[model samples]
Target: MTMKGLYNSFMYAARAHAKWEIETSFNIIKNRKQLLILFIMALPLLIPAMAHAADFIGGKSAFGPSFFSPTTFYGSIAVGVVAGLITGCIGAGGGFVITPALMSLGVKGILAVGTDMFHIFAKAIMGTTLHKKMGNVHAGLAIAFLIGSGLGVTGGGMINRALFNYNPVMSDLLISSVYVILLGFLGFFALSEYIGMRKKSPKGGDAHGGPDEMTALGAKLQSINLAPMIKFDEHVVPGGRRISGIFVAICGSVTGFLASILGVGGGFVTFPMFVYGLGISTGTTVGTDILQIIFTAGYGSIAQYAIYGYVFYTLAMGMLLGSLFGIQVGAITTKVVPGTQIKAFYALAILAGFVNRLFALPEKLAQMNYITLVPSTAAIITKIGVWLFFGLVSIFAFWIIGTFIANIPKLRAESGYDVEDTKGGVSQ
Candidate 1:
């Protein structure tokens, strides 16, 4: 063939090859979407099983304050680091883990909670700093929430002390009741918000009113002269700046009190309050919640050092290792999962936890007539039940993680393409 003809033939072959590659890419994309859906469907089953297997509770080494001893203090630091690492990785404050771990080590519930607070404070600060860098955290909102949260902690602490002195059992029950209530309300509220968002979407005119509703509520509040209205991107208010100050102080006091009393980081409540009541975005809410917890938890940890001094270094270190990787994995996963889905799942989880707390485990166990059953059979059944619950959870978690990992490349590609297409559309 002539040189020009030969070049033409080569071009034709290249075009055919390119078309084949495109077809293959399209097929891969289709398969990935299916995989993603399947993965999500499997998560609920997996998460519970993982929770059982993960040994989320029951550690004697985590029970008490050993901060008086350098060894214990150092050990607690290690534990805090591990727990903090997990919080960082999982997008949680790790108060759940730290408190339980401390309790297992013989730490009094009150002191363990205080120590956990200190740890949360430290980790939250770090997480907040990262979020701030990423521009996900709203400084104005965070400062506002901090004010309320700090006051809440202090108030909660005082209330706890008074109640404990008056009647420890009643105090415990009261706190538990509050937790149950908070959990229930939060779950319901979050679910409602999620539903409202869905309804407001273009698919439903009735549901499509979230922003309008938010605006209307904001306007009403602004008209009330609530004081200290710090305007961020969302709303402009007459006195929005002052709102977070007093409210945050109140929240802080209550949160502190709760931490001192029940040993929880209050993230669950705080997250909802910021989003619904505070009117901040979800990302900002999560970022701010983590930040505030760090400071509050830090103070609690220091107090532990001065008084009871119980910190388990070994356990903390181990936890830190596990949690650090988990956070990165979770953060990345968040990108793939729709925000609405994440919120709904979180709400459901909170609601479930609330329901679980309403019924006492020990009491239920006592009520069961296992004594009348065959000893060997009963023992086998119990062991199987425990293992099955956790083992399945682990498998499900692994499945979700694996699916997320598999789809990450696809998500990034799609996102990048969308951005380019949007830019191109705008330019034209």
Candidate 2:
């Protein structure tokens, strides 16, 4: 490859990866096997929540917040509805809201992260199913990517715990800062995609890009003939494009690390990585992401966060229930709504998160004496930011639900009048 080739390779990879980061999101549901697993793994975490009312109800602790108040119940439901709407339609930005929303509501930072992961784990069990085609997955690709992701999660979990132990205030600031950056980047691209769509089709059409394909840069990398090569998705690729197993694993590790730290399923990161980096088919990528979320979220929530007493079970359960309804409604709305509007909403959700964290940062810094500021000023600003975020999210959720209601006759007509049984939502 020439110098220009090298630069292009780098830029192309960035572009592809950016697509993955912005486009990946979520879906959810349940099975008996998952319930058994959750029971076994989360038993310890839930026991604490089931504690006597003698325990502090709203009190914050290293363990987590005590639970089951009317306020907590309603609040968790509201949060889940908006989050589900984001995940169902936009395919990103939902999980990003949970931790920040919880923290703003006075849940401890670590607890909020853990609870979100646990909730996702439960949701994945319910929502995810493997490829309808039994042979859909490329075995070599799945194994390599999973190995890499597992390792990444282990490393990320250690880092998160180490930071918390080192300085709780610093931990809060760091997590907040990471969210601010991630949400800002996502929000920017989402708005850009929406704007591009509007400019191209003033009458309103789907503007989001189509299914990802292996680009020329990806093709170049696949031709390297590196050692430990793996041929994947031969059905889609005539020759079954080969890439080094090591390369595949490295991509998985990056995805896993980000997912674990953020307390998400990692689909948002993994989808693009597989499709663009490894050049996997979108169909196969979706299958792989579903499997990966179950493993990643479970391991991170139980082994990494829950073991350290950082999860909130009641909140997770509440969100799970509420998301089922919200995701269903939002998914239906997608059929009637324009992709441009979805992109706009996605941008708003992400930007709201960015603002929430950005405003909360100074308060955390002041707590650590990293900066000097009046407590009242910092608190007021943080309060405003959090409320503003909730306001935007509320607007997004109501709009989606209202749209679904308004379009019920149209949707029902399309579905042979089987609206109740044929919701056909996997609750992504």
Candidate 3:
């Protein structure tokens, strides 16, 4: 496939995943049972607050100040809001920015990964409505995938912890290096696509430019009669298509490993792997991806990170709250914004993240004594990256909010609500 085709496929998958996340978040908010569960999960925050009180009263406390802080709490919410805005407006998974944003806020890389995983886990649990999509799911395929993913999650978690124990700087370096590579590749392609669209049409084209076709690799894999074949897409084609369970498991393993290491819930990777690599029908891919996220994120967070004291519950909750609000606003704002502008922002946002991680590398390298550099110079570079990233994100957020506010009258009118102007305020 050509580079452009590959990029389109990636965007299509990412958009689908983002839509699921947004819908799930909204459902969780509207469901009383889910809200209650969320409340129960947040009850743990009281423990940290109580500990803080004890320390304030001149008593010893096991919980450190790091466990709960006002600044970090609010900062996490802001990070989540920005991520949600990108996801909602750009129609792609905004999760790519979460870890880097956390790291920029002085969060430990491992802790950030763990916290993000927990956030995704909480969202998945509250938002999952598998019964609705069960018809699209292939039981045999999901089972094989989960088995491999379990093993992959375990291995990935171990690697991260081992690096952290050996040298915290090394752990940060690994995580930063991974983001740099990923964001750089995605960002470059995204920018290229944006430029291509501008040249082709004054208005931006659809984010997903074309339909996905089965790849040559996928065709070859399906033809192989490896043991334990999985049948799927009976609804789509006669006799349905079958691929080896082994291949499904392999794809699951890669997805799990990346999810554990990056704390992205793996949905972004799962979609492409299933649709493009394995040639699964999109219906099956979507249903199966949702199931895999709940399991992969839950297992990776609780089994690997939470139990190890790496997960920050407060931050996770804060982000969840912020993203819920942000996603709604962003989705609505997209109605008024031009598609081309949204595409440009998406490319810029990814590039900003790439720059943030890339520049921060020098500081980690300097601390590890891997490179000779002045500490001040390293700090300056890192600061520049942080400013550039947050600056772009802030601008996007403001624009979305501004558009939403400005278009409120029109939005209200469309929704059959009348707006009345008062002396100093407007009421709907």
- TM-score winner among the candidates? 3
Which 10-residue window of candidate 2 scores lowest in summed lDDT?
17-26
Q: Arrange candidates, best lDDT first.
A: 3, 2, 1
Off by over 4 Å in 1: 1-112, 115-118, 125-151, 158-176, 184-248, 255-291, 304-306, 310-314, 333-356, 359-396, 402-428
RMSD of each: 17.4, 6.4, 5.3
TM-scores across all candidates?
0.50, 0.79, 0.90
TM-score of 1: 0.50
Residue 197 C-alpha lDDT in model 3: 71
Tens-digit per-residue lDDT, 1-428, candidate 2:
34323322322333332223222222223346655654554343356655333122122343444334557657887888888787666655477788888777766676677778888776655544443423556678788888998999888888887888887777678778888887777667657657877888645532232233566657877888887999777778576678899888898899789877777767666655665566677666665665676778888888888777676666777677676667667766889988778878888988898899999998998999989999999999899998999999989998898889899999888777465445665323
Q: 427, model 1: CA deviation in Å?
A: 16
Residue-level lDDT of model 1, residues 51-167, one tens digit each, is: 233222212223332333334434454444433322322333333334434433334445455545543342343232343323655676667666665555556566655554565
lDDT of 3 at 68: 42
Clashes of 1: 91
Top model by lDDT, which number? Answer: 3
